[model samples]
Target: MDSGIICNNALITLIAIQNPVDRKAIERIKEMKNWQKKEFGQEIITLLRSL
Candidate 1:
């Protein structure tokens, strides 16, 4: 089930769990080296904030 977009498991897992973001998670996301991870993290945060 590829969406034809770069995948980020950390964000995927975070969203799958449907848990609120905490400072530790934010920091961990920031420390990720992959661009997809960072992008997904941002998207997740944005999505969460809009709710």
Candidate 2:
């Protein structure tokens, strides 16, 4: 399986936990390089928005 897909699946699981989106989560996303952001940004944004 693609590593990006694997990572995204893990992210989905993490988001499933009841905790609120924290500064650390936002910072981690911000720390991602442009290419990484391109790979995962939209899914992250969509998931967080759904919360």
Candidate 3:
């Protein structure tokens, strides 16, 4: 799927985790522009895949 969808799913998973969610960070991510989200998501995906 596209980076945006992947990013959203990742965020959802993070929120579902037992650990405390960082509301401020989530809000910042949610406020990001579409292109920014796409780039950020793609980078994250790439980084994770490389690990």
- Tens digit per residue, CA lDDT, model 3, 2-45: 76654466664663342223333434555345665455545544
Candidate 3 least-lDDT 10 residues: 18-27
* lDDT (Cα, tens digit) per residue for candidate 2, span 1-51: 777644666555654553325444644653355665566556666677786
C-alpha TM-score for every candidate:
0.39, 0.40, 0.30
lDDT of 3: 0.48
Candidate 1, position 3, lDDT: 57
Clashes of each: 0, 0, 0
Q: Which segments of model 1 are wrong by more than 4 Å?
A: 1-5, 8-14, 18-33
> Quick one: ranking by lDDT, best first?
1, 2, 3
Higher-scoring candidate on lDDT, 1 or 3: 1
lDDT of 1: 0.56
Winner by lDDT: 1
Which pairs, if any, clash in model 1?
none
Which candidate leads in TM-score?
2
Candidate 3, after superposition: displacement of residue 48 in Å?
Answer: 0.4
